[model samples]
Target: MKTNFLAAAAASFVVAGASVASAQDADAPWEQSPFRCEPGETYVMNVMVSGVEYWFPVYEMFKQAAHQFGCEADYTGTPEYDVNKQIATFEQALAKQPAGILLHPMNPDPFVEPINRATEAGTAVVTFAADSPNSKRVSYVTSDNAREGRVAAQQVAEDMGGSGQYAVLENPGQDNHDRRVAAFIEEMEDNYPDMELVGRASTGQDPNKAYQAVLSLAQANPELGAVFMPEASSAMGAAQAAKEAGGDIRVMSVDVNASVLDMIQAGEMFGAINPNQGTQGYYGFLLLWLAKHPELIDPMNDHAEAGFNPMGIPVLDNGYSVVTQENAESFYWDKYLKKRGTRGIEG
Candidate 1:
């Protein structure tokens, strides 16, 4: 179903007022759950990014969780968004053979065998951010990407009155981006038949390319009602292009960058989906660490009569948030910043 953006934005203040009047509870899960690790327990993490702001918070969260668990953590990744490079890093991580490895697989297929090899070699392995769904990885930590896409599409369709031309900004051929786009298109086709998806362009997570894509779409289809970007960098460019064009096109995207949050607060952006990057890193590592030490988790698994460690699940749903002006203040980065220090938010 579609949502009324104007109505939601307007009512947010009222809802905030009501919640404040009702209760002042401040207990969140992150604050309650203790970090699970032991002293001298060393871990290594490999991410997939080229120093983008999006991935840094995730790393920081992972580090913070590692600290809480009394484990040492290290993060390194490629300078560019290259699957081959990420694969090489994964191989290198296997070489160092730390207690466990947290990886964000670049592709869904090629990383499967290597991840299996890592797990078989007894190096507790888990996937984060993105996953190789077919691999033997212990846990897959990430926001529900498909659900995020479906939500974005539903919101866009509702905002546009369920009819009009729309476009998508994708991250080249990335599997995560592909999954999101596919879900969005499927949602539109199955539910909002009146909404036409006219264009799908790749921005490569570069602002200029994103700008060009949105600019081209707006120029080609002046009637374009909304645009959804699955990546944060491209979302920024889409907002700029939408602003420059001065059209009715509403913008929606994924992730929570400081600037993006500000834009959403100022009503410049329609809304943003926050996958809680910090939590992803924190929990991704926790699962891997726990998998390595079955003693700690065996009780819960055995009590529930569950199977052995790793769970062998196809995918793990980390979580996501639909951030708007009303709740932006509550979702601060202090916890992540405190652990990562200045370095945490910088990247």
Candidate 2:
């Protein structure tokens, strides 16, 4: 009886050992698992960006999409918006030999060569937020910035009766802000001929500078019908300046910062063009996923049959929102503010 019991115990031990080995094998990295790419099948991605406030929502969307297809994604970037630092981060991400990269380039031209190298080496490269227009990236996922500029300008023009001196509190030489300013100017020139763009001031995305600029503009030109700020932080300061100046100057700006929403509801500012933060994250991921798993999406006839990239230059207009008094309450800030005790669009 003792011998038989020992024999059964030994068999059970062997079975348990086999189960543990199988579990460890299953948990191995993509490079080690049997499900891993045979030679070039595994796909890994890196998302390099600046700060969490301005662009993190977009990256979060991309992160979710990566999970859907069982791929790995890493998000890394400089904390303080340094162009050189961001470039270095991109270089480090490339060193990992990732299958793809989603980059929000600080300098458009400097990133061209590195992004091209990644593309030429069969790495799928894509841009979001700050796009490198000349890079060999797969696609860009962002709002139609020029349209947003035009929309904001029109809102200002309507508020001020299509005529009055207006000024732009800009982000200096950034591509997105530059495009927005240009579009705003073009819209004013083409449509609202009566409206005059008095000044184009560079605040460097600083609230203090933005406030000073708007204050000076308001003081100098009481006829200053509207002040257009193409950033959220600047918008808050600009609104404060307008209030301090104690004049009829209206404020219309870009983005949905929590403070901007409060200003809108309180009638301190006109409105803001709100791009959906959650959607930026949701669709940015979808594009990255499609770039990695080309099989899931149908191929375009214009592209080659043997090629894998079938998305065919798909431009997603994630679209924008104008946060005005009429629908300010309907915006999604209440839940976020209550749940997180944090301020984003709620501020």
Candidate 3:
């Protein structure tokens, strides 16, 4: 019955033109109906480096929530880790005129204009994993990057017995990565002074650059106890470099891909600080959804007089998890993909 009704409705709507659509969309009482999307409403989850495995689980949950709301959802971004390219892709998504966008901005300050423009154009934008704090984006969702760094630091320091030398590989311009690296270094300075941060290098999230950085750092700091990076892409190469240079240097980083999990299980690298990506997507969609339909709330604020929506949540911490050798098997991408029976981020 529901299928037949939808089919019939779609057929009737095809004959009605822009005037009918404008009437339905602008003045219809959508809140009186079930919490579902109106026809033609769509949302998108955008990110940089579209090919990475880290985004798959996030989008899976995003897609699930969009389905529940009877809305269209798409995953889009630049395949390369280039900010200008990513911004261009973001603008392309904007051109589709989606109801909302859940974006992972490649850089913070650079996204201010785009976010503001989207907001002014009445398309809700929510950021995830990374943020544009100064933007007009409705909400920013992700794990606590500072805490992730501190946690990684504690694990690495403990593994190294709270003594000896350490180094860091970084991607300097990215907000979340910079926070993690700074917090990791600060945690060491405050908690474990004996663990010296002897070297620093910018890998730009490239595995080859990370490999070369670690190789040189190992040569310079022979007593290096552990090396840390902000993300798992670099962790893979750092682990390999540490092994080649003399497997004594423990490697620690944030996030876990399939290969990172495999390495953790094999004891080639230490654990990772993995964000709760599922929650990131789920709540990110919720925020975007609510932000778009601000008519649902009439809060006890000056929103009506000021002409602003009542729904305003600046930040949402989706939380994080530690993936170590003990839990590495459970965190494997293949296992999760197989259990869920999804094509991951490809679709």
Candidate 4:
């Protein structure tokens, strides 16, 4: 009886050992595990203005997701706002044949060919923040620009007692910015009957240009109660101009950085509409990974034969929130960086 019991115990141990070995083999970096990355398989997060603090949080989460899957991640982009320079940087990244790319195309049309080319070459490309709709990119992850603009309009109009003149500073030709501006105007015209759009200026995201534009708007429309823009890069100069012009203008925009949060906390500016940037980074990576491993999907459609990505998702809205004086502390970039214990995007 003792010998028989020992034999059964040894057999059970062997089965458990084999199970452990199989699991470890499945997770080996040298092998292509369904959910794990093979050795040297790297994914990249590419943006237009690499130094902008806005992209850092996004990259932080992107890097976190990559690490979870035993994959490598890198951040690359041009410091300048020039689309050509960004495209050049993108081409350089593409030349390496990286496993995947999460790109924020500075513009849509100009990126179509490049995005399509990358996908055609079997490298998965997923766009974030902005999109190249006419391209073969797998998907886009972003907040709804139209909804963000509408919310901004409502907040500004309510702050002005629902009857006032407002101006808009713009970055023309950028798809997301254009959508936000268009939606802001439409919301004002449709819902806030008492509010009037006094003027619009293309700031081109240059703070000095925004400064000049706000000053000109304040001078041209003496009753201007507020000024809105699609992004926060120009908000610093716009707020300064507003302060110079008696500080009553509600200077608001979308997205935020360290300075913007500080300005909000100090009441130097009204508020900001900020996107959920972490979601953009985290889910953006997932979409890119899934697109790269399309064989995991046995969908009804024959995406491979059709020369299309199997994910087939056009866009995703990550959602956003309003950043005001009461909650501005939670959005401070420095505080977040301290907690994260990493350089914004340098790592």
Candidate 5:
């Protein structure tokens, strides 16, 4: 009887050992894991408006990519709109010596030196949503801002029958915002000659400022048919002002949030251009990781002569979608993720 008990215990031990080994193998990094990053190697996603809802999915995707490749990921930045403060936060992130960084620079000028410094320290960096072209960052990933602007303008102008008075709510200093505004204006002038731009006001990153700007513009240009802003924060206020003014002015902009999606669904907004933010974060990390360890994807020829450096792929357009009332339900980040069988940040 004692011999039978010992044999059963040994069998149980072997089964437990096999279970442990299976678990470890399941958690092992994928075959293509870049650099075979050391166990503690970390990556970070840094941005200016860290608390914004639009960025939640971006960071979530970044985290998911890190998890897949067997690395740690973190988020750090300032909620303020100050470029200097964002630069300071960036420098702080650098002190951690992360393996790579994904940055959403608040302005083009302030990030040039910090990005160069990070790259010099052998930390890979990639810019997304906004960029510093003069910086030595590995790559810039985003929707084509100029094309998004042109598309938004075309949607509004065509909806208005190609003839209407419109006003712009601008965020003047941001490189991406400025590009969108410029393209919108050019599209209007060249394609919709009947559309007149009556006024321009700087909202800078404030929704209240956008609200007041729209109110004043509507007062001045009572015949205004539409108002376009480079981003969605301003759209919330602009929609409210248009509703309060009892005007038929259509509100259009770029980017999406729950509020903006709700507005579109209720017909309070004309439409929005949503850049594939998840793709931006996922590929941004891929670029940064590749830049850190180019050996993972070596090519046959010298890349410099081929004009196709692996570390930096130049600009990658993640593409965009125009969201209207008919399809606004499909663009909310959380709902979109749920439909794909994935949980966002919290998961």
Candidate 6:
């Protein structure tokens, strides 16, 4: 389904409105008797890498959902980008016996054992952004990564007059990033034969690495028309390099932060794909809560399954938008929240 970018941009406020409106009515869905969390029960959001500006709105929306459901949510992850460290942290969180977990696994393989243990121990697990499909995780939530890549490819190729040399900055070994880069290349090969992929580099979530990569790529391929990355951190550095190199190479990426938004506004970036991060966090918690308390939703089902049967292992595509200078201001999480009259995490 095609996403309504403007509506998706306003969705967080719509959720906030529902929260406020639900507060006044005694029969509100959130106030229903069956879905309440037990005393002392809490939820946790875990990621392999933390400390990026992109995660701030995600955790804020997660906290908002937890508050609505009368539960607490905490964030835990390693800043080192090591899958082993993340697994250790996940084990540590599991030891506390949280009501559920929202995980963003860095790699699919390293998380299988931990997710299985969490499921067997009765903690509901839902992955977001990145997924571990082989594990017993109940659900996975994310924007359409392949679609993001195709959209970026089409936009860049069309802007470059359907024929130009391009390069990709990849975050290697991450499934989501791999999907995006793969789809981007596939789209270019299938539709834009003239748009040749001149180079590929592994930036690995570091802006400095991306900066150097872009500079090196440009130095080697002076006729390079565009560059694409799966996330914003690399785009930040890539944009700076393009600026220093006479602003001929266009940069495109997925996800947005203040710096990326500013770059777009300043015409340093071609565009970006913005996933529904608020929905990822809010519904991620909802799915985990329902998985933990299947009885709450069992009335709608005829099956006689009992005790955390995972409800269903559904994948949710939260949708995304291609953000350009015309609407770049509205895509900023802070500005979106402020315009919606909702306070951010600090507020």
Query: By lDDT, who's the top model here?
Result: 4
lDDT of 1 by residue, 241-286 (tens): 8888894678888886766777777777788788877767766765
Residues 224-262, candidate 4, lDDT per residue (tens digit)? 999999998999889989999999999999999888888
Using TM-score as the measure, the top candidate is 4
Runs off by more than 4 Å, candidate 4: 1-32
Clashes of each: 1, 7, 0, 0, 0, 0
Flag the better candidate by lDDT, 2 or 6: 6
Model 1 poorest 10 in a row by lDDT: 1-10
The CA lDDT at 238 in model 4 is: 96
lDDT of each: 0.74, 0.69, 0.86, 0.86, 0.83, 0.84
The total number of steric clashes, by the backbone 3 Å criterion, in model 5 comes to: 0
User: Please, what are the lDDT tens digits per residue for candidate 5 over residues 9-114?
Assistant: 3334334644555566766544432234578779999988777777877887788878776789888899998999999999999999999999999999888999
TM-score quality measure for candidate 6: 0.87
Per-residue C-alpha lDDT of model 6 across residues 1-347, encoded as one tens digit per residue: 33344334234433564566577675677545445666778999998667776776777788887887688888988887788999999999999999999999999998999999999998989999999999989888788889889999999999999999999999888999999999999999999999999999998888999999999999999999899999998999999999888899999999999999999999999899888788778767776776787653334454565533635446777778889999998878777787657666454
Q: What residue runs in model 5 are displaced by over 4 Å at the alpha carbon? A: 1-35, 297-309, 337-343
TM-score of 2: 0.76
Candidate 2 structure quality by residue, lDDT tens digits, 1-347 = 44234334333433464465568886655444322223433333333334435454555555555554456666767665567777777788777777777777766888889888987776777676567888777777667789989998888887777887888888755777788888988999999999998887888767788899998887778778788877787888888888888846788887766677788898898888877765665555555544654543454475565543664344555667888988877554555445646443212
Ranking by lDDT: 4, 3, 6, 5, 1, 2
- Candidate 6 deviant stretches above 4 angstroms: 1-32, 297-310, 337-347
RMSD to the hidden true structure, all candidates: 9.6, 13.4, 8.5, 9.8, 11.7, 4.6
Q: With candidate 6 superimposed using the best TM-score fit, by how many Å does residue 226's alpha carbon deviate from the native?
A: 0.3
Span of 10 residues, lowest total lDDT, candidate 5: 2-11
